[model samples]
Target: MITKEALERVRGWFAGRLPEDWRAAPADITVDREEITVRLTIPDVDLPADTAEAEADEARAGRAKAFREETREQRMKIAQEAQHRYERKVSWGVSVGGREELWTHVSAPVMTRLRQPQRLVLDTLVEAGVARSRSEALAWCVRLVGQHEDEWLGELREAMGHVADVRRKGPAA
Candidate 1:
């Protein structure tokens, strides 16, 4: 499990390395065991007041795409350095005009053994066409749980963080 202090260090490192002009504010960094995701919010594109909603959206998407292309090399370099230092894959994303796009993110396969009941639930989702396969169904279920129980999960994570801190302060084994 990643400690709060380690997460903060990752955030601080990105904050120092990222160019000020690249993001309107500091990057939003999230780290898990396998990867670190860095999301930067760029300045909104300027459009005519009379621009149609669809046109405005297209413009925003274009801006995001252009930024992605323009900064590809720099982003790659930074990601390489971060991956080496953190020993995890690095994913990049950009948010522009209320839209967010993630590119080059890792999709790691997870292995688990499910009991009959759990397997049935996943099969039901596949039969209903909610997901294409057992893996997809399981992922869908996990995402649903995350969305619905976000607050509870957040509190649980905080408690776990506190526990980790206490353990760290205890004598070494």
Candidate 2:
């Protein structure tokens, strides 16, 4: 987990550096032990499809091709800037938006083997109307914890780092 001070610094940096048009889109900023990541919600733009439209004439097709190429080039530069400025170890996640479904109960997937009792608890959230599905219930639980117990979470993460350091030392030290 990132320290609160680091998070604040990164947020300020992003606020100052990002262009106004890009800033209009929302971002999910997270700090793990190794890197700070930002998942930005791209603005809804008329993105070009890979397949050419049958209705488009030659001139229209040429113009659309040029426009799409320009957009792609601009996006690459933005990503390069973010990678250079923000992350220390890994790259930040950036994309042109099409993740409207993620806003709902169906969010990103995490693959983990949970005990049967834990699965039942997640199911209970669905039955109690707290979430839409097992996945949603799990996400809801995580978000609830993050909102309410950030400091504890941060301390726990720091402790885990200590544990890792100890484990790396091996026995008979």
Candidate 3:
């Protein structure tokens, strides 16, 4: 859970820095700055209702079994498959819009002077629909930090330079 103040500062940074085009997309985007977490809801897959409860309960009482022996193996297999799938899908990039949304979720401390560039990247990703929201983009960013680290760092550096220019130019004089 990010502190309230940290969240406010990051939002302030966005409010002060984000470009109009990027901000124009619906502002309903939410960010949690402390945990460096962003949350977006996607439609969840519906699970089938269990219909064998009664029979299973009777069998459980007679057998005194507390767990499914077969389920353990199945769970391991599913876990491995999911991990493989995640690795394969990790390359998917977020839209710029989503990247902006992600920047909104990051803390002001970590983003520092490069907040806007980070925001831009995230926003671009979101607009492209590579990620569903800021949080997802951040997650993906963190996951691929090793590969995309230089690009991200470059964006941060660029943002810092822009901020410096803004400060020096004094807001359009």
Candidate 1 lDDT over residue span 1-173, tens digit each: 89999999999999999989999978999899999999999999998899999998988899999999999999999999999999999999999989889998889899999999999999999999999999999999999999999999999999999999999999999
Candidate order by lDDT, decreasing, is 1, 2, 3
Angstrom error of the Cα, residue 90, model 1: value is: 0.8
Report how far residue 79 has shifted in candidate 2, in Å: 3.4
Residue 133, model 3: Cα distance from true site in angstroms = 0.4
Candidate 3 ranges beyond 4 A from true positions:
1-114, 147-173
lDDT of 2 by residue, 1-173 (tens): 45555667776766666556543465666665555555555444454665354433443444434434554555456546655776553333434333221111112357878999999999999999999999889888889999899999878977876776666678866
**Model 2: CA > 4 A from native:** 1-29, 32-77, 83-107, 160-173
What's the distance in Å from true for residue 167, model 2? 9.0
- What would the per-residue lDDT of candidate 3 be over residues 1-173, giving only the tens digit for each residue? 33344445544543443334322242232333222222222222222457365654454333222222323354345334433533211111112312211222223334334388897887787889989877667666776885768787657756765676566668565
| Number of clashes recorded per candidate | 0, 0, 21
Give the candidate number with the greatest lDDT. Answer: 1
- Candidate 2 worst ten-residue window by lDDT: 98-107
Better of 2 and 3 by TM-score: 2
